[model samples]
Target: MQRLYARARRAWDRPLTAYYLVLGGSLLLTALGLVMVFSASQIEALQSGLPSTYFFQKQLVAAALGALLMLAASRMPVKLHRACAYPLLAASVFLLCLVQVPGIGHAVNGNQNWIQLGGPFQLQPSEFAKLGLVLWGADLLARKGEKRLLTQWKHMLVPLVPVAFMLLGLIMLGGDMGTAIILTAILFGLLWLLGAPTRLFATTLAVAATLGFLLIKSSPNRMARLGCLGATDPGPEDQCWQAVHGIYALASGGWFGSGLGASVEKWGQLPEPHTDFIFAVTGEELGLAGTLSVLALFAALGYAGIRVAGRTEDPFVRYAAGGVTTWITAQAVVNIGAVLGLLPIAGVPLPLFSYGGSALLPTMFAIGLLIAFARSDPAARAALDMRQPVFGRMRAGVRRKTMRRRAERPPSGER
Candidate 1:
């Protein structure tokens, strides 16, 4: 055990560790999510008179597109990313505003945060808004830091806080408290990363908490969701139906689970089995072992993101990475906690592991952002440079072997 720990420590100390962890962990979770989505959504799709593969096919296409986006993001220069900050944020804001327009906007499960794009496709602006806030907030702070303006409380909170509140207000207009919570998390994350004074942080937290409580109190649906925490009964009118079923799914999974694709809950007992409650289905089918594996992947991804943030010299990279980390981590905890009955069901999808193109696309791009930052590290860059020749030689050796085998082989026609 000691030897293993030492070996792991050494590996963790390597320059490229963060890069590989971010890449590998994100990919693994995505792949697993695709499998689970297929398994969990088939029943729902068929029941809706669609092909069994409908949801999975859509998710597959989204994953493909997201992969391309991630690759492009990873290859982009830091300057290009910074340049995109304002435009992306602008686009996100525009789309978010569009979602509030009667003819353009669409609601799903009471959240008026979507825009229907012809035929089975929908755009969720809030998802992109999360990304927008991270980039814009980071850039804002980075510039302020460079100007030494962050020392003043007003400079730190002025535009950033106001703009964040604007975005939050827009989101709340759609009645998406779940997303609102995530946006608030990102806001606090940015402030915390900027090393806000304790008093300011406390004040901000208090205000957020108060606003959240008021929001919850104002909406019956939101109130019911909050009241469902740790609830075993389905409540009057089955308000806790989804929550209770989620727990049931996990409870039945035991230690090793019932095996993949065999979840009974997905057969109509559980709601949103492929999206928000996918974790419960995962626990049911893959058991504690599978759930733990998923948790481990998230832990690795979060740890890698932290390493990237801590090791970076660039202020933008540090703030951006920290913000992304906080966003993903907070969302995951809320999602999994809700499934476990430890928290209220927030309607947030598990990051990189749920069936939502809007969520997955931005998240994969964020992973790419981490990858880019990891590569930017001086030591990581040097290590990659050192590895080029070895990889080239290996490729050359494989080519030579293939050529020799081809030359020595009988022609297809002659055989």
Candidate 2:
């Protein structure tokens, strides 16, 4: 017990508060996600003539790989990452463009967004695009700060918003409103962190929101889904297949779940028992208790990510860390909320838990970046090694002068 306490104290002496929070939260969430994926995917898997552990097995592999990536990323030198930021960002953009090509890009659902690389591995350019933009934005913003220029904020939107829109346009062209929405959110968050003028942000946001609304309203499929949103009672099984089923699963679980592996909903009642709507499987199989547990896990992640942002001294670390957290946690909240019929039905995946290769890889790398910053912060180091600097000669000079003055002084009582 004493050893544990001492070790924990040593850990706290560093700026790793956020690092631990984000990394630990990510691991916890991944574990929980794996279990839920199995619970949720069983029915869908069975229906598709696959094994019960199919999704779980894949997710588990992804998690293991992600863990290694996280560690490698955390241990990587900060300068290397900074140096590679631009090129990585550019490559991600290029990939995003490639995914838009006819032969290269694979269509899923209605979105021609994924680039399938044979062997069950599908790459989503938008996923990499998100990370690239975050890294690129961080580097750009930091350089602006280094130059000690405030006016750069005005010109900042020029390249940034266009690049963001280009990514958004390409994603939208692929019919991925969810990815576009997420990209928009990330961009706005980055801009906010960059200290863009408030009035400009407000004006730009209104215009973009207006455009987003028009796009959604114009799409029949999106409009149909939007119609089901904000409903007091959803019928995902009827008009809203996913939502109604999710509600059923939640209601079935009641309190202490039907017990793990006891979910009937995974049998086929839920369209995507393991993927986007896995939360429903959790609610049905684990009940309200299970659902709450999952919620608590995410809450912990959000808190930890925020802690990391707060602990960092550099704006780049702070922005990148917090931005990644926002991308993941915010998306989770939106996904779960939409599933439970609390919000509109948008096809956003729950991070780390969702069965997508593209999302998992980038998310893992982002967590790695968070860990990297957390592991090597100078502020954290200074706090841990609180030894004052030694100035031997200067110290001797001051001490000798004090002694001489004292010796030369007349007795205090003489006056």
Candidate 3:
């Protein structure tokens, strides 16, 4: 346990600035989650004759445990993350495969993507897959960059794209479209940061957009959602009910919100209050002001990730940090967008803010990686070197003493 704690502290101690960024982001999100969960779940529990704070209590435990894991991960170096990437990727893939097995995996809302871990907590393998794929992709790209993929895409990217698609294909089998899209965004972001071929990325983006349209349109349930956007009367239990309720929650909040835990929509009117639609509850109880605050928090996270990526010279560190950062930020955007009715719902949870052990722990661990890379930066070392006043004074004194002795000495012949 001592060893474990030391390792985790290394990530935080690596760079004070990086540590602060992660700390701020983590604390803000956790605090915001606590508030929103309570606001969203209060009415939900009353409607169902359960404890009003049931969801909040569970989320608090998960967040606390997740923080512990994050600290442990932060102590590791980038080399450690790179070395473990492959094994982690393989493990996540295996778990995802297990989730597909009958009787082993549990089905929820038409998608059989969750595995019952024999507890109140269920494991979402795709969440782990997102983290694994990011690290693995980063490792691959770092190797390519080492071999000068900075100038050679044909040899590097051809191999890279397939691995990405393979992971996406496996995830899509669960019909987890939101996770797939988030993974794709991370992949593209990493590739872009690694300087992958521009034409390839743009072309792939176009193709992806087309495929996403086809996927959504193929399902009548999803198609109805798109059609209901313009319809005033979507009926009582139609496609628009969820989205319309979400919108009403936001509008009801007005500016300052209806005070904490006073949301009326969470009274079974809005669906998935503790899951994908958590953002709707935020808007409903905390109002537009609160929703924007959440957005700003994610914006800060993206900034930190970008800064870390830019600070590191190691390709592996850059890609891994950037990939993970992109993954979380992108997921946050998609979740918020879905709640705002700007996008069709695809059942993506709100990263740290959502009540899921799987998403929370892995995400916190990834942030730990970001801090590790940021702390190990070349500039940080230089700054530390400059701060050692004792060493600087010692060297300065030595130079002056030598100059004084030389001045007092006779010519070289006398010496």
Candidate 4:
């Protein structure tokens, strides 16, 4: 057992461990998401007079596209990522602005944050903005130097805070407080990675809390959601309906679950069985084991992301990994928290597990960015290079065999 443990330790210590960890976790989550989405959406799709596989087909297509994007990003050179930072940020800002164009932007569920891009297709700029912020912040800080940002608070806060707020304002204008909160998380996560002063963090936290209170108080729906705290049963018909159903779904599933595609809540009881509340459906259908596995995979992904950041010497890679890690993990926490009734419903989709094309695309790309960072580690690059097949190995083996045969001849005279 000790020998096996030592072997496992050695394997885990490899430079490529971070890369494999991220890949494995992301793929598992994506696959599981497909299964859950299909199961949860079956009844809804059929009720809409569409094929039973309508939502599943759409989700599968999105997943395929996302996988291609992820692969492209993963193979991209780190320098290329840095080079594209400004352009990507600029484009994201333009899209965010364009989303506010009257008649051009589309509204859904009180949030006018999406733009219709032809039939049955909509694009969410806020999702792209998350990626943009991470890249732009990392590039800016990496250029200024991580040490300067750490020592000088002014250097850290200057344009970053203002730009972040501007983005937040744009998102909030569209009534998407959820996306705004996530953007804030990315900004602060980057700041924290740079070792911002504790006082600064505290100040920011207080301000954010105050602002969040104001935002929540301004919306009746948000207030109702906040009121769901410590509720045994949903009060009004439309008040805590989603939250209550989510809990009911979870409670209905014991240890092994009711089996896949057998979730009672997804039939009609639970709203958004495949999106924001998908975790609850997962619990109902696959049980405690499914939910725990999802959490474990996310934890592994987070560890891999942090490991990549820590092992890298490049400031850009470090900051980017840190920001991406925080973005994915924070959003996951919010999504899961809402489903578990621990927090107000934030309408944020679970990373790699939700039924939204817009969310999945950028998230997969971000995971790819993490993979790129892991691959860029010098030791990891060397190890991967050594794995490539080489015809020279065959020639070297032949040369060694000849040399051994000659040596076995017992010298020039003895042969």
Candidate 5:
């Protein structure tokens, strides 16, 4: 057993290990999400007089688009990503503001965070804002390090806190406490990664807690959800119905599960089975084994991301990887915790496993950014080139194409 463990550790120490781990874990989660979405949505689709595959088909389409974006992002140069940081941030802020337009912004479940594109199509600016904030914060902090300015708490918080408040203010204006919470988590993670002073963090934490309390207290819906926390019996209160049913869904699945497409709660009892509560659907259909597998995959992804952050020499890579890791891992914790009744239902989607296009696209793209960072590692790049000779050939082919194009062009003004 000791030898086996040693061998495994040695293998994991390889350069491309993090890359493969992230790729494998992401693919697995996406595949599981597709299956679970189908299982959880079939009953609801039929009840709505639509084809049983309706929701599943939509999810599959979104996954396909996300995959394409992921691929493109992975191949992009790291500098390009950094260069686009401010622009992405600006666009996110603009979109968030646009979602407040009375005629353009669409409300669903009391959250006016969606901008209508067309019938049955809406874009959630908050989702993309998470990515923008990650990129922008990472770049900003990395720049601070270049000037030796990260030592002081003031330098660290200067633009970050104010900008974070701006984003949070916009999200709150739209009544999306869930997205706001996740955004706050991202900012906290970035600051922590930047090594903010202990006193600063303590003060920030207290203020954050106070603000969180105020936000929740201000919302009757939020308060009602919180009231379900220690309920012995939910007793048919609409607020607790979803929470109670989520627990029931998980309970119904014992060791192995009720089997795919066999969840009773998804048939009618559980709400948002395909979205915020997909984890419960996963448990109900695939059981304890499935949920554990999902957990393991997320754990692997988190480990790989942290490894990239630690091993990289680039400050930007370190900051970006750390921020992205925190965002996804923290979001997953919020999601799974709510499903398991360990935390208040925050209405946050499971990172890659939830059935929402807005969340999935940026998430997959973020994974791609991680891949780009992993590839930036010299050893990883060497390993990839060695493993895939076609990449070298493609580089050569591109050079040849450029040379040929130059040669084919008419001389000076001869054309």
Candidate 6:
């Protein structure tokens, strides 16, 4: 057992481990999410007079586009990414502001945070705002750190906190408390990575908590969501209808589950089965084993992200990776916690596991950011360089064989 443990540690310490974990874990979660979305959404789509595969098809297309974006991001240099920070933030802020305009902005499920984009499609700028904040905030802190200005409390909180608040205020203006909470998490995450003083951190946390409490209290809907925590019975008007149904779906799947596409709750009982409560549907269809597997995949991805952040020499890489990790981790925890009745329903989709194109696209790009950082490590870069020739030789051999076969073969028309 000791030898086994030692071997595992050595393998984990390899230069390429973080890269492989991010790549493999993200792919698996996305693929599984596609499968679950197809399963969970069929009934809802059919009831809406659309094809059973409608949602799945849209998600598939988004995944394809996201893959291209991921590929492009992974190949970009650190300097290039840093250069893109301000532009991306500007675009995010612009789109987010656009969502507030009448006739242009749209609402879904009571959240006015979308812009209609022609037939059967919409844009959620808040999702991209999360990515923008990660990159922009990282760059901001990295610059300050280089100048040794972070030691002062004012410098630490000045522009970063204010910009984050501006974004949060915009998000909250659309009544998207869930997204605002996530943005707040990303801000604190950046500050934490910078090693802010304990008193400052605590004071900031208290202020955020007070504001959050006020926000939640002012909205009856938000209050109702909070009241549903650990609820065993659906409240008045079935206020906990979605929450209760989610629990029932999870409970019905004892160990292995009812099998994929066989969930009863998704047939109209549970709300947002393909978006918010998809984890419950996953439990109902794939069982506890499937749920645990999903959790493990997220854990692996989060761990790999932390490793990339911790092992990096560049302050930008460290802060950006840490911020991304915090965003995804916080969103996932809030989402999964709501499904399990451990916390209030925040209406945030699970990272990479929920069926929203807006959410998936930015997340995949963030995963690619981690991949880029992992590859930037000196040891990992060297390892990759050593393997390039092997791949090149394999490609060369394949081309030669293909050409030889072509020369020896008869024309297709003759055949």
Which candidate number would show the highest lDDT if scored against the true structure? 6
Q: Where in model 4 is the C-alpha error above 4 Å?
A: 1-5, 146-150, 390-415
- Which tens-of-lDDT digit does each residue in 335-371 have in candidate 5? 9998888888888999989888999999999999998
Candidate 6 error regions (>4 Å): 400-415
* Clash pairs detected, candidate 5: none
lDDT of 1 by residue, 1-415 (tens): 9999999999889999999999999999999999999999999999999999999999999999999999999999988888888998999999999999998999998889999998899999999999999999999999999999999999989899899999999999998888999999999999999999999999999999999999989888888888998899998899999999999999999999999899999999999999999999999999999999999999998999999999999999999999999999999999999999998888999998899998999998988999999999999999999999999999999999999999999999999
Give the TM-scores of the predictions, in the order they appear.
0.97, 0.85, 0.84, 0.92, 0.92, 0.97
Score residue 96 of candidate 4 by CA lDDT. 87
RMSD of each: 1.7, 13.3, 12.4, 7.0, 6.9, 1.8
Write one digit per residue (lDDT tens) for candidate 3, span 1-415. 9999998878645555664676687779988887788777777777777788877888888888888878777788677888888998899889888887988888778877899978667888888888888888888877866776557657556766777787777787888888898988987887788775768778878887898788887878767766656344546676688877888888899997897878888888889897889988888778889888888888878877887887777888888878988898889888887777787776899988977778888898887787677667876756656778878899999999999998998998876
Point out the higher-scoring one by TM-score: 3 or 6. Answer: 6
Candidate 5 structure lDDT: 0.91
How big is the positional error of residue 340 in model 4, measured in Å on the Cα after superposition? 0.7
Worst 10 residues of 1 by lDDT: 218-227
Better of 3 and 5 by lDDT: 5
Candidate 6, residue 23: CA error in Å? 0.3
Please count the clashing residue pairs in each candidate, in the order shown.
Answer: 1, 10, 4, 0, 0, 0
Pick out the ten consecutive residues of candidate 2 with the lowest summed lDDT: 383-392
Clashing pairs in 6: none
